[model samples]
Target: MRLSFTTISIFLSLIRAPGVVSQTGLAPKQFLNLPLGEVKPAGWLHDQLMVQTNGLAGHEHDFYDYVAETDWTGGSSYYSNLEEAGSYWFNGMVPNGVLANDATIQSQTQYFLDYVLDHQDSTGWLGPEVNTTKPRYLWGRYPFFFGAIQMVEANSSLAGRVVPALHTFVKLANTMLHNNGEGLEDWTNTRWEDFVMTLQWCLYDFYPDGNEELLLDTMQLLKSYGDPWEEVFKEEYFPKTAVENLTNPFPFLTWHGVNMAEGLKALPATYRFTHNQSDLDAASLGWDLLFQYHGRPSGIFAADEYLAGLEAARGTELCLVVETMFSGSYLYQVIGDPKFADRVERVAYNALPATLTGDMWSRQYLQQQNQIAAKNMNPDPFPTDGSYSNVFGLEPNYPCCTVNHPQGYPKFISNAFVTSPDKTSLVHVYLGPFSTQTTLADGNQVTVTVDTLYPFSDTLTTTIEAAGAFTYRVRIPSWVANGTISVNGAQAEAVSPSNGLHSVSVAAGTTTIVLNLPAEITLEPRPHGSVAVHRGPLHYAFDIARTQKVLAQNAQEARAVDLEFDATVPWQYALDTSSLRFQYSPPASGVLPSPVYDSGLPPMSISATACQIDWSVAGDTFASPPPTSPECTGPTTNITLWPFGATKLRIGEFPTVNLTA
Candidate 1:
């Protein structure tokens, strides 16, 4: 007899009554995620969406039609390509759908929802029917997990339609666990269980009463099947001393760059249910180990395939950067640590923008800290990724980044605002131009509108609209010292230094707060005696002129363009450490194009004196030049540096010379 979803069927049937499933579950009280559509992107972030609409993410059907026609049936056994397109549409499109007020956006959202609604099997299985031979291919269902979460968070009616399917899918999944776990063995394939655990826990929180036993049973089984994140970190299995680390032939399965990025939050997310201290410790420890040896100034770790060492010339995958950002968002929710927010800001501001064209039309799969060129070569610097990995195009080397990159900015906007457990305070997890509206515990409506060009300018203004008094919490980043907060033009004392939240009581009606976090330039020492320049969260690089080449577009796909960039200007420059100047310009002040990314225009630029220093190139990529004294062979000239995100060929980590030393 075939196994049946007996446990799940009973749980679902019991909860058919209205209001039986409560909107509460095992998520910790301190981490309350606000409903979507409450906070919308404004200013430069909104401009980014306009640019994205012209890119691969907005026209999903144009570039990724495979997903549109797959019909959620496991076509070729890689889970469901439908999930990929669905995930992007749900995350990237919905935000634009609501914000842009475009009909196409709503129709696109409905396109995915309709398939999910129409195709759910009688046994409650979601997505394409599993091909038992390639059963582990179910890893693709993880995208559906994301899509479901976003749907429930954004729309009540849509969520109402989705919860029943989710419950049924959970039951079907639980039934599969009873049969010796056929497809859940491999490390790479098994990673999907982490998503399952997370979705299950989130659903449990929504329906806590009737389905406790079944949810726990499924979760425990997933935990058993997941990669040994706890043990791996405890034993320091990563950053392995010997190249032959894992005895298995496919060691990259465990040490893969993107895998590690997705896995970073796995344990912390599980901690939501387990509440185990060791799980929390594993998340922190694993982060430290990854950063200690492979970290870059952009707040990402180097990984051409695996944990490449801490050299400036090495590249990190674009997918890893976005995944790390997602992980950081979760860690912040779970741990409430400001440091996680710091990571999120660094990647969003620097690494993410650096990899893609300003217009969001094209992107590279791999971005290097000391990249001097981005052309296609047969023998690329990457160990495993192809030569085209650095090309800016649609699906250059991997389609995963193309599909996954859209999640970063939209999710970042979503995470900008959250409330304290007691609902007496609202926290700004990230600083940008956005407004947050949420109700307090005392039944008071509070709305805070944040206006500023942050990371571009230190001056931020917050306007509070509330009739009653409540605490307002502002995050003072750890890097900012002597930070000042002013209310209604009155200067307040510096409250916290270690990335703490500074709270102040407000008098209800239209209170304005101004925050001044002065940016200071600091030189960070890196591997091979190189240096990275940092001012606030943005990293400064020696900007090299780019030679743009438009490789032909796909004949089959509409407007799908391929691009390659070559370094045109001289890249061999060593900075004079003592002479750095800050130049500020408001948006659209320059002759550059409207969208900052589209024109490679930064809202602010830094002027620094530099002299041509001796640097070598190895196989068309920049080599780590040795540190030298303040001797200059060429005349001292001033070079302008925008943020790392605004440049395609940039020497972000440079060899510095100290004249006085």
Candidate 2:
């Protein structure tokens, strides 16, 4: 008999490991990310995702040809697009959100799921086998494994098939490794090998019966071939040298920004399987080094194919943004680290939005932190990126970002709330509007509704409906200096979030927890003595007026209409740092409107007195922030700055002048 999704969810809730499997390698009792649709995104987050579904992710076939396949799984077409389409189907656009019950989404997503589950070979290969005539091009298999993770997370009915299939595939792959050292080839040396480790750990977590032997054997196999990152990082980054002077011995791993970002989770995953403190240290050190030299104001590392230095004009690939986000999501689940969640939020709030059009119709292949133009140029700011790298259009330079970008928003929303290992507590990781239903370890079911305009307004309220009492934990960001929590109406004096999390006993029958998170504005020093402004999690940038020019249909792909944005107003401004102040316009009293862009009618603005500096342009693009302590050239003027994502073209990192001095 066919059962409802809610019924299936309840059944899965009761289905525990016979003893305690570490096949997934994650300690389920510590933290559990709910199924994809269990926690639904609402408010502006919901609206943004809806726009994406209607814009490109929903109608992907209308614009691109490769991902339009229902049966074709050949390697000739980029498989990342299909994987991306699957993620979009499961997470954001298709089966959930505004189009939750849409028949087209239901059929398309179900067919894709069926394709993998029904077409598995007797040998247990999941997706289409590329190069059947020759040895499997091992590297290509990794993405399907990566993509399968979303399926297993979203569809409970498929777990029985997916889990066993994963077991068969990993064991087969392991055997192939033994026969001729299959995966130990050149491409496997890159961090992509980490997926094997992750997949094994997932299997280990799935089977309570214990597959420890197979797990360790696979780990050892990958370790022999994968990048010897811990040793290389410790030697190259020892004494933790400054970023600008740091040179990577393995240019293959370090120079490729997306690879570097994707590799960040490898050590963290290693720590999960081995519980090695050194692995954890390596993960921590890796983060320290990335932000030191190649970091952008948007909480991403600079890479326009290579690790460009910290000049804001240098570009960051959109692929790296989504990949790093995916890495952080996994890292947080395995280690229960709050810092990983914080990194996720910084990228989500700043970089994700800045790179996409407000309507989600277009995106940049590479976006600059101090961008003043988004047009094609003779010499792109990115040394390796193509001419159309900065164009706000569909599939500007490559199709990778277009296919990969959909996972960021939906995954962020899915991870907003998670259950503790024992299922007696709920943890609200990121600030967003969403609701989730989960069964506690004690067999009581609970529902949580998060209500707020978080990352915009500081106030957040969560209402709990449950059959019994449970511990409700709220993540208090380190950036929040004055955070307070109240239950029902009385202040929860016993709850101190000094350790980044606050837990309080939430009784059944509509218990409400109100959080007051106060933010403070501060100037973050940037490269070459410039500074990017920040208030709590949001980055502030000069709101520049943009005049979009539709580029002449010059590319071979005539269907791909590109756009160029020109900043009409003067962008060479140096802030009078002392005159900065913020004036907030709170959300309207009842039923918040469609999408609020950080403010209302008068427009919530951060005003400061500033003067035009001698900052010039590099070709048509805004030049790098004038070297340390720029000298003013024009009289002081009042200027407004808004959240970095609100403006199409912005000066995010700016030079500063001591006007009084």
Candidate 3:
């Protein structure tokens, strides 16, 4: 049922995760995964997104006050309501501009600094321990660690705040490593969330002068305490101890979505920072094992409160997708390969959007494939209370997702544009405007000014400057609008795609790559069971209000119309060159409908009217046979499929319909 793929042959020839190849022995030119940011979209959007989150969230102290005031803890009220409010605010501060002389950032960030300084003990430790002797908040170390690492990435001045916090982390590590008198469990009354968070934060700070002994100690302790990631990849990772942990699935592959994912996402980053090759390699291998057991096409491994089979109605929690993206970013840095970045992009583009509303507000607990509308009970054999896309306000159905989710947007901004070990930098994504500077390889300095209207348009440009000669390799995205290169201003002829990169050689000179994303909105069906509608990197969905098709079907069963919206007559036929579309439509003899997002999945509760997908069906012509019954007909139509994760009601896996007419 799976289309065999070769190892990815694209991206710079960096050390990516091991390859998955096709029967042809060809690897994929690009590994479609998460943390996708082309400098064009990633740079600007990262900056803008940062601005949005921090602006909405307030400084940590302010946000802390707001959430604390609500007195909500570890429940839906906290997860959905308080957590999301926190996320929206945090999103505003992620990218470059958000911190570019922004007064709010300067002030609010300072407040957190003041809080840490005010609390530092004589030993340099920052926060109070979570025990009868000292418990600052109702939670453990995880959230605080995530917040602190994020704050460090936001700005260096904020970094000054980290030292004191490290002290506190070291003390906590001391307890866990030593197993001092219920010391570790005392943090959250034995809850592992705090312990895991504490461990991850320590990992982030692994460097010279770091608590190295403590880190090794905690890693051993974590191994013993059933870190699920450790267990799932035990044989693959700790072949030494596979006999011990892999024998049981308790902590090896538990299906609960949020907790285990959070740990996987963070633990690897820690190992990456310390040059713990064995740990990093083990962690990545474990991720592969996890993917084998529970990966979604969206690039997130499943988290359905437990592992659900691949096509099952229950799968990955929105929270798991976000966490996976965060973790993948670190994998990118550690492995220095664009493959990890590709995975990040896949999840970011597909799964992230599915979790939240179009406007970047609200998210879901679980995201399903046979996602049914919230209004009814199991109408399909596969139906479950779980939904495809859910959007509610603040903390929607669960607060853990809400609280955990907020960290993603801002953190995403930080990793969007990355530098090479040699100081070469790239504008990985397109969203808004921003700037960054890096020390390039060969001891040279370079700064980039990026401009684009990405995910909206494909055309974008990046200008680089350095005093000396250097070769900066820019990425040519697989879904590029259209690619061309210009040295300074002179356009270069297209060269053969080398390792998936179109190398534009510039000898100690400035250059520009004119990127054009396809402006045309196109649709492609899949072999398994869905279709994708695309306009550049931004996948288009259907307008429920005007759409005539709503059933989720395969290429054979479904169809789409080329739509052109008119100011006067909106749903009027826009006409494609071909004379075909889907089978089921306005029953009898009416127009076939388009897939819409109004299924009312409770976890997300997304507003039906906001940001109507730019498309709606205006016609349908069968290219193949229709299903026997309305409920279970498979798609018989033959059509090119848009990428999975781009749109709802599209085929991710497909079947051939081979119709000539």
Candidate 4:
């Protein structure tokens, strides 16, 4: 039996599930994400987002063929015979346009949404799949719904239409799954967590009493039919070595880079339903092992296409970086671990932007920690990538990163803050220049404004305005020691963080709190006896001078071009770890410059003494792994290092040279 729209609304209001806990012992999420548009970017973070809006991301539909003429928007063709490219664009564009409040972007997104919703099939299937006899692929719908739900949440005016449509689709999906799990294959099967996540949202947030059991059963069927990520994460089944070294016919899905990134949260997502202790333990074990062997200093694992090992020169895909950030964000919310949030910041601040051009007009399909050149490689280091894999341009080597990269920072902003399970407090999950307005459980209206250049600047000034008393919590990154928080100019107290978060009992009215997270120069030992420099959330890299060569350009957008870069200055260096010093230069204008990711724009840097070392490039394109031990080959000179995200060409991992020896 189907419930009418009025009955569905009544049920939703009456049984709005507080959290994803059940009598069957499903695990409860520690935190719940604030609805889209509630958290908005501010200060330098907003500037960075504006850069995205002005660059390729904001203009894709106007020029890029895949998005401009894709079937998702009533165009005549599917992108590469699949709905993925357009769906990816929709996923990123929805949040970006909503958060930026850009009229053009909003109009573009609305146009696409209108088309898809207006043309839904009689069988409740979304998009143009109804007209084709080709096998339906469920993978693309995961991203489409992810974006659709956000659009509905941000613009509630669309709710009456969008919500009921989504329910109809879910009912059809249940029927399809029951009929031998049709349409779930390959990518969709491996990434079933994405589908499960959307279902969980529908079940917990908008479930109708009549179809409650159907939704739950569909989730179970999808899990059963999908790739066994939880089982693959087991010690015996997990691949400890690189994919290249694995025996024939190894679990290819687990070794795939993007799959690994998206799969990281599979067990944790599953634990919510099963509540099995093994699922939780396995999730933790898989995370530890994934990073322990294949991880890079940038907080991503090597996977040009598959899992590469811990060499500094190995490439990490752009898709992996953003997916990893999402997984990290999801894990933090589900498991309530501060480390997950920490890792998300690492990838977002360093790896995500590092792959994209400063203006966000172009991007690299793959990025290396020790990258010194951005040209086509003759003998590419990647196991399966092409020669142009590392080139910084539009759709270099592949188009997935092109369409998918836009979601990185915007979603990061969307999840910057979350409400506690009981909704008594608002938790700042990730530190950034953003503000949030959320209503607490007791009907207290709370508005929080954070003003600071975090990751670049360690000081965060938080102003909380509330209608009544409530607890305010902020995450103290795992790297922070000797951090202090002062309330309303009171004497600063040492921040005593429990489980990576510090709580303050704040009374109603306007309260101002200041957080001083002073960071020290820390060195991480790399695989080749080299050290990677870090200060707070930013990873420092030597800013190598480079020359750009434009290979192709779009007539529609002057800034959109396929480009290659070659280092003009020597990049082989061995640092004197003892000589590392952190420096901060506040912007004179009291505001960060637009396009802040450009070289030399960040207000903070590191100075260190280093000398040219005997290092070589692989295939005359990629930087070879740093030497295990290196002796100086040139006179020592002081070098300035900027944030990894700031430079187009850099050496983030440096070998050490002993001058005394």
By summed lDDT, the worst window of 10 consecutive residues in model 4 runs over 14-23
- Report the C-alpha lDDT of model 2 over 1-661, residue by residue, as the tens digit: 2345575455434431123333344323247777666778776677766766765666554335545543244445435323333333333333333223345655655565566666667875555544344445455455555545555665667677767777777777778667656644555556644555456435666542366677666665665556656744553543232233444544245557777777887777666655667877787777767777677767777888877877888888887998788777767776666887887888998898888877676789998888888988655666677878889887788767776677677778777888877777888888877788778877888888888777777778888998998888888887886677888888544347745788888887789888888778888888777888888788888867888777754243453457898887898898877888987877567344454442222234578888897776777765655567777788889999888867668888888888877
Mind giving the per-residue lDDT tens digits that candidate 4 earns over 163-277? 7787788888878877777887778778888888887765445545466666666667677766667656767656666677665232357578998899987888787777777
Point out the worst 10-residue segment of candidate 2 by lDDT. Answer: 14-23
Alpha carbon lDDT at 236, candidate 4? 67
Where is model 1 more than 4 Å wrong at Cα?
A: 1-29, 68-92, 99-101, 130-133, 185-197, 240-252, 497-499, 556-559, 587-593, 598-600, 621-631, 659-661
The lDDT for every candidate, in the order shown, is 0.70, 0.69, 0.41, 0.83
The order of the candidates by TM-score, greatest first, is 4, 1, 2, 3
Ten contiguous residues with the weakest lDDT in model 1: 15-24
- Candidate 4: global Cα-lDDT? 0.83
Could you list the CA RMSD of all candidates, in the order they appear? 6.8, 8.9, 12.9, 7.1
Mind giving the per-residue lDDT tens digits that candidate 3 earns over 475-523? 5555544455555666544434443344444455465655443434444
List TM-score per model, in order: 0.89, 0.87, 0.62, 0.94
Q: Using alpha carbons, what is the TM-score of model 3?
A: 0.62
Q: Estimate, for each residue in 266-300, the C-alpha lDDT of model 1 and write its tens digit.
A: 77766766667777888888887888767889888
Clashes of each: 7, 17, 109, 0
Best by lDDT: 4
